[model samples]
Target: MKRFTKFVFKALVGFLALSLGLVLLFKFVPVPVTATMVMDGNGITKNWESLSNIDRNMVRAVIAAEDGKFCSHDGFDREAIEKAIERNAQGGRIRGGSTISQQTAKNVFLWQGGGYFRKGLEAYFTVLIEQIWGKRRIMEVYLNVAETGIGTYGAEAGAQRYFNKSAASLTPTEAARMAAALPQPKERSVVNPGGWLRRHGNTIAARIGSVSRDGLDSCIYE
Candidate 1:
């Protein structure tokens, strides 16, 4: 028992140290790849762009479409999580309340899919990033590491693939279209969207103005 306890203690300490080192390293360094990117069977297409290089419209579009309270939340949104739980209890498609920070942590440090163990690790990494990466760095990494389209990762690749333009040149409508597709990059259509996808993109585009006017994207800019 004593020997087993000692082994567990050392293993726990080693894991913590390694996780911290990786988080700190990524705070300044561009992440080369992620578990999601590696697991993508379609092949990888990405071009790293600094946050400043990506259009502000893209940031506002994602904030409006995904997490309205992004600027105010730490790493998790308890109210959203509660709502998701309540909805899930009723039985239908499962919903998630992951904030941008949580998504970033999962995308960068963990693999896709959900189980209590994976979710726990996601929560752990989310806290680490919120503390070490800050809102701006979190947003930057999220934009870069997120799977934006089939076989494509990041805003740069997504924009070029969909609009034949650079991420820095995306307009509000274009950005919204990309943002709408982000939730289901493999299935959603960005180039010639219609039906629900088109409507959702329009709604996101309309909300982008409010995101800017209301300063919901203040954290990223500041």
Candidate 2:
């Protein structure tokens, strides 16, 4: 029993060291690929751009649509998680409460799916990224690596494919539409949005100004 315990302890230490080293390395390097990007099969269509090169409207829209408290949270949003749990208990459509930081960690380092093991690893990576990468770098990586559409990834590729424009040129409405499609990129079309998408996009657009005015997006700039 003592020998078995020693082996488990050593294995845990080795795993922690390797995961930390990889996360630290990625902080300085642009991630070239992710599990989801490869899973899509056609290969990633990413053109990694600096946060500045991606329009401010896009940033605001994403925050409004995804995580309103992104700038203030560490790696999780407790209230949103509670709400999601409560809603799911009612047996309606399932919902998610993952914050932007969690999503970024999963997108950049982990694969898709939900399980206790995967969620644990995602939480681990989320804490690592929030500590090592900071808010700006996290947002930059998220914008560049998120799967935006079928066979398309990143803000730049999504913009060009759906709007024939650059991410830097995306207007508020256009950005909101893009943000709206993020939850189900394969099903939602930003260029030719359905009525529900249009309404959701407009709702996000209305909140973008509040997100900025309330300084909920200041961390990225600061």
Candidate 3:
């Protein structure tokens, strides 16, 4: 029992150290690819863009569509989590309450899944990123790595692939449409929007102004 406990303790310490080191390393190094991006096979069509070059409209639209309280929250959104839990209990279509930060951590450092072990590691990485990367870096990394469409990765690639334009030139409506497809990028076509996507994009477009007006996205600027 004593020997087993010692082994477990050493393993835990080693895991923590390795995880922390990786997180720290990524803070300075641009992530070239993610597990999902690799798994997709056709290869990622990402042209990395700096935050300033990626258009503020795209930023606002994404924040409004995905996480309204991104600038203020730590690693989790408690209210959103609570609401997701309640809605999931009622149960028709399952809902997810993962914040942008959590998604970023998972996308950059881990694979996609809902396993307990994955969730636990996601939580750990989320905390590490929130502490080490800061809001601006987190948002930047997310914009640069998020799987925007099938074989598409990052704002630049998504913009070019869907609109034949650069990410820096994305209009508010265009950005909103892109943001709308984020939840199910593979199935939702941003270029040729369906009824649901049109409505959802409109909703996100409407909310974008409020996110900026209320300074809900000010952290990136700070």
Candidate 4:
């Protein structure tokens, strides 16, 4: 029992240290990943500062596609999580109802998997990301790393590759399509808006009037 307790304590300490290290590393390192979305028709690493305010379209689209309750919560949304749990329970593999913070945790630290162990780690990392990176930074990283196309990543890259525009200038429909393509970015086409894209686009458009960019300022990162 004592040995088990010791092991647990050490693991907790190690987790804390590792989490801090990740926060520092992502903050300083322009995380070097191939742009999923091509920028200027050329695939390259797109790195931008965290302070950059993204297009209202992009923000609204992301919210519409991902977490609708991002503005109302701290790090997690229990209701969405419950729905996800019920869905995943009915199905075999795990499905996520993660908010942006939780998604950032999985994207940054954990492997893309649906295992219970991975889910727990994702939660741990989510807490850490929420604590360290705050809301705006989380949003910034999410936009930049979110896969925009098959092998196309980052908002700048996605905008230029899909619509021949910059991230700042993406229209509501364009942004909505990009956000909608997130679940299967590599398999799905951001450049071509198919059925899901059109449906999600319309959904985002309706929410665009209410999704609050101003409220993001209150996020822990901001």
Query: For model 3, what is the alpha-carbon lDDT of residue 81?
Result: 92
Q: Could you give me the TM-score of model 1 versus the true structure?
A: 0.99
Give the local distance difference test score of model 4. Answer: 0.72
Quote the lDDT for 216 in model 2: 86
Model 2 over residues 1-222: C-alpha lDDT tens digits?
Answer: 999999999999999999899889988888898899889877668798888999988999999999999999998999999999999999989898999999999998899999999999999999999999999999999999998999888999999998899999998899999999999998898887878888999999898899889998999876
Cα-based TM-score, every candidate: 0.99, 0.96, 0.95, 0.80
- Expressed as tens digits, the lDDT of each residue in 1-222 for candidate 3 is 999999999999999999899889988888888999889877768888888889888999999999998998898999999999999999799898999999999999899878889988888899999999999889999999998998899999999999999999888899999999998989998988979889999999898889889998899865
Clashing pairs in 1: none
- State how far residue 203 of model 2 sits from its true place (Å): 1.2
Off by over 4 Å in 4: 1-15, 33-53, 92-94, 213-222
Q: Each prediction's Cα lDDT score?
A: 0.95, 0.92, 0.91, 0.72
Predicted structure 4, TM vs. truth: 0.80
Q: Provide the global lDDT of candidate 1 against the true structure.
A: 0.95
Off by over 4 Å in 2: 1-3
Q: Across residues 90-193, which tens digit of lDDT does each residue of candidate 4 receive?
A: 98866778898887777667666577898888888777777777676788888877766755567887787888877887788888888888887766676666
Superior by TM-score: candidate 1 or candidate 2: 1
Candidate 2 Cα RMSD (Å): 1.3
